[model samples]
Target: MIKAVFFDFYYTLCVWGQSLEPRLRKITERYGFEVDPERYVKARENLYAEASGSDPTTHSLLGTMQEIIGSYCEFIKGLGVQEHVEQIAWELLQSEHSLFAASAATLYDDAIPTLEHLRDAGFKLAIVSNWDTPLDPLTERLGIAHYFDIIVASHDERVKSAKPDPHIFNYTLAKVGVSAEAVVHVGDTYEADIVGARNAGIRSIKIDREG
Candidate 1:
């Protein structure tokens, strides 16, 4: 019998669209500067492309934000928006709370009820997320933090490796004090969740939100 269930955070337990706009606005406000949201979007997209690759460097949201903001400042100068760049940086620095707000991402209607049912049925709960930001506050915001017996965020040095690496899955199972055969994982990423769980000798369920 499966005694425990592990879950992935983004796309599995949550969903969002255009998540960066709020922070972009906050930055603009702080700097007393303005730019077409579309331009900022382009800059952000460029930054994402620059930071992304197969080098296997574990990713962090906070670090990415810093890089993206810096890139945007330089790009804005090219676009003649240099005066407003510091405002953007200042806003980003002050808007950690607002950025955290994006973490909600509208949990699936079935997610909570399913979690409650499983918990009541004696299933141990844990979260194994590949996020650069601290997840404890976001879990508290979701009100389901208590449901989890353990929460592991990639930001924690203990999880030096990111998804697609079985280290995290193995570590989580170890923490829950369960054997791989007695645990199951649920996540949205085929490579990360499915492959990682399989590598760790655990069964996995992939949630396809589009389906």
Candidate 2:
């Protein structure tokens, strides 16, 4: 029997608002980068996909920030905007980070209700996310923090490893006081969430909301 349940954060429990594009545009303009909105979005998507597969523990927050800045610089350079690429990338990073830190992502319609039901059913709930930002504040802001027994973020000192590395999952399992065989994880990403959970010897469910 599954005694504990773990969930992924972004795209699984909550989604970014429609203002994401406008916010991106604002940041790009503020940084003096002449980027086509559509192309920028596609580039971001591709970069994110590539990043998700790699191990996040290899870089500290500062290192990751620098890496992101470099990626953005290269992306803009490819777009024929070569001057001040580094400065503009740094500005864009700061602006996007602030935007995300503020109010941007909203909880899914079924998120709260499902969590409530799971908690009521006596299952220990936790959030295991491969995220750099703290999950506590975001979950609290979303009003779903109470339902979770723990929130494990990959960037945290306790678990520097991201999903698919198994370190984060092992940490979460230990914190939840549940054996891997007794827990079930649900997430959207196949490579990160599903593979990570499996590597930790935990069962997993992939929730494909769009499909």
Candidate 3:
């Protein structure tokens, strides 16, 4: 019997509210480069998946500031920016243009209802995500923080590793005081959540928020 539930942050429960596309285009055009918004989003989605797969990483969850910026540089270069990629990427790394911009994402319409139902059903709830940034501010603002018994991120000092690394899930299970057989993790990604949970001896359900 499942006595607990774990959720992924992005897409599963929340989505980004704004796009940096317009700003990216403005910046790119200023530098004599061009970018297509759809392609940009698509490319980034691919990059993030690659990062999760065994670049064995998460959203700078374990990266230093310099390392994260280097990833952005690679993103610009991948966009076919032959020159000034570093400069352009650096400028775009500004908080306003950053992927980690504060309260940049909002919860899904059903997020609260789903969480409340689970809690009412007597399940322990948690959020275990590969996010690099601290989620307190966003969770608080979204008004969903209180619903969770605990929230763990790859960036957290206590986490042994990020998703796809079973240790992260093991750590969470230990903290939640729940057994692997009694917990079910729900997340948007397969490799990060499903694979990790399976490896850790926990069951998981992959969600397709995009679909």
* Error of model 2, residue 196, in angstroms: 0.8
Query: What lDDT does the true structure give each of the candidates?
Result: 0.70, 0.76, 0.76
TM-score per prediction, in order, is: 0.65, 0.73, 0.74
Whole-model alpha-carbon lDDT for candidate 3: 0.76
Model 3 ranges with Cα > 4 A deviation: 19-42, 53-63, 79-100
Q: Each model's RMSD to truth, in Å?
A: 6.6, 4.3, 4.1
TM-score of 3: 0.74
Over 14-104, each residue of candidate 1 has an lDDT whose tens digit, in order, gives: 6554334565565566667665756765665454334221112354565656654565466555334657566655454444323544643
Candidate 1: list runs displaced more than 4 Å.
17-62, 66-104
Clashes of 3: 0
Query: Model 1 reaches what TM-score against the true structure?
Result: 0.65
Which has the greatest TM-score?
Answer: 3
TM-score preference between candidates 1 and 2, better one? 2
* Model 2 worst lDDT run, 10 consecutive residues: 93-102
